[model samples]
Target: MEEIRPDENTKPLTWKQYLVIASLLFGLFFGAGNLIFPVHLGQLAGAKWLAATAGFLVTAVLLPLLAVLAISVSHAKGIYDIGRPLGRKFALAFMVLIHLTLGPLFATPRTASISFSVGLQPVLPAKLAQPCLLVFSAIFFILAFIISYQETTILDSVGRVLNPIFLLLLFVVFLLAAAKPMGAAHQQTVTAAYHNMAFFNGFLQGYNTMDALAGLAFGYTIVSAVKQLGKTSAKSNAKVTASAGVIATGAIGLIYIALIWLGATTLKHFKPSAEGGTAFNQIVTYYLGDFGHALLATLVTLTCLTTAVGLLAAFAQDFHRSFSKISYHTWLAIMTFASFVTANFGLDTIIAWSTPMLMFLYPIAIVLIVLSIAKTAFAGDPVVYFWAIGLTMIPALLDMLASFPPVISQSPWAHFIKELQVRLLPLAAIGLDWVIPAAVGIAAGLLVHFYRKRPKQ
Candidate 1:
């Protein structure tokens, strides 16, 4: 094959080209996790679906899109490079956190639960489901290993094939909801503040999906994809990459909105239960009948299966890179075993434990993304990130402790912080004691930046 060179003088990517790039990113970002969260938010928000969905979109859709843009703008080679401003230790931890979040502890096992529940369980008897799930996950991971080894086509092909199927299933569900919305139409009950605050809540929830971190890791994949699509110049590729991001964000947003609408309308038929997975199954069966349930199960399983494979591949790749002592196969085996154990806890339990930790981590992740994209102004200074993140850490750690107190009774600092929040701080809500600290960190970073830039005598 001949070598292809990127033109130094490239033109802007056309709209058609941009949409394809966006669609590809959207496929990578949207999967089993994307389906349940917004739907649940819609049901809770109800007439307030618009407000809740708005919040949901900020996190679910917008932040991930911002992450992709950050990667493109920074042109970072890896996750650490994008987050390198936070100092070497912080960057490693961020990498570890991002990988683990998207790995066996959370996203990987989630694949198993979502796949089995949505895809496989409907056909099997309750007693047989667990065994069947084990068998299915084994085969699934093996295939993922083989395909990922090739590293060229499998992920792309699975995404291309599955994206349409997933969209079709969603459309069928939405159509059924539209033809006969579940409950009597009620007036929307969204408060002005909730509506106004939608952006922050949505941005925060974006953490649940873990796409922003993935964007930092996988932005190059997108840049390469842009080049392959004939935008082979630096300027053209940059424009194309950005345009694709816009396209992906728009598409994902539309689907999220539609699902939220469905979820809000679904309340007319379903109740607000704590069980997200079961609730999803119930809603699908109710609206679309047996066929809908079957279709949903299949779609969820396929999407989750692909996602599991992808995560396994990522875990293996990152682990091998981080510690060259382990062979790639060893890393895969380690992750697979971990995933099996974690998957047993089930999706609801995982999501429950995950939420509070996410509250602490999400803000830090957001700051990293914004800073990475705006790295030019900061001159890639680690001190700026170090102090900013160091300040944020106090609150993040406090927030984590506040979420689960009994586990850390020995720590005097935790005790002091908890007492301080109760006695002195005016928090926005119970879980977010970190808001004040994050603001302070931002202010500190700006002051330091200007001070360092001042002319010496």
Candidate 2:
């Protein structure tokens, strides 16, 4: 393996290479959650779409962009490097948890299930839905495994072809929706959750997308891709990576806005559903009728397949690097097989199982990204990371408890803790109970850091 040196002289990537890498990154991040969440948000937010969309974009777009930039600028090898300031043990644990969450645990299985339910379920006959889902998921994971099995060609295969086709099909749906216009954007009745604090609701909703986490996970892969494009030096890699991020940013921002607008306008014609997949299917069917099913099925399948490939490849590569005894091929096979089995649990169950974990992990991920980007201000002190993450964990744990299903939530201890959190923690009702504690931790950590380093009196 040729090592990428910090000082190696390297040429910058061409605009074409940048576009390909950017497309690949975009495809990786824009999986099941990305497609469903925004459209559902637009429907729920209704008249408040602008403010709500802004909130969604903050976490969904801005934070993920910062995450990628942090990785590039720091020249970190992977997510483990980002968490190194915490401790070696902590870094390894965090990286493993992140990989699991983003891989076979939740996201990888979701790609197949979401596509099957939303895309194929509507088109297939009633009796065939079950067996078809089994067949579809098997095929989906097999294809993903095949694509990911060859690590080097992922960018060329996914970026250069599949992603563009996905975009074109998506454009057809969006363009026709705009041209036809589905009744005016009406200020429809929103759910109780969205009626008040819609912006915050939107912010929390964005957490489900998990793109920021994916950004961190995908950082090393993007860097490798950049190196494959012949940018070996740290500076060249960072520059190319940042440029690719910009292109992805533009692409994602435009798609989100379009999807949100589509949802908002179509609300007058169609009632909103709890599942974005259902709403999306209805919207497509309304415009293109039965023919739209084929278009949507193709788009959804490709979108999900590309994302699963990226994730499986990234996860396998990281784990293989960490534990050299386990070969990359073995890890890839394990991930694909696990994802295939989990996909059989279906979309709803996966979402239910994953939500609690995501609620717990998201706040920590956000704090880490912020700390990484601002590490210089604290002189890269480990104490800062320790304090910030430790304090943030308190409320993050509580947030997870709050999101627990009835079995857990109905417990006496859970009820007591829930009441305590709501009573004592600021913003607990909106799922942001960690904000104040994190701020306090940062301030406290900075004070200690500066005091310890002060000149002798």
Q: lDDT per model, in order?
A: 0.70, 0.81
Clash counts for all predictions: 9, 0
Evaluate model 1: give its lDDT. 0.70
Give the runs in model 1 whose Cα sits over 4 Å from its true position: 1-9, 120-155, 184-204, 227-238, 404-419, 428-430
What RMSD value applies to candidate 2? 3.0
Model 2 C-alpha lDDT per residue in residues 418-456, reported as the tens digit of each score: 999999999998889999999999888898899999999
TM-scores across all candidates? 0.86, 0.90
Tell me how many residue pairs clash in candidate 1: 9
Model 2 clash pairs are: none
The positional error of residue 307 in candidate 2, measured at the CA in angstroms, is 2.2
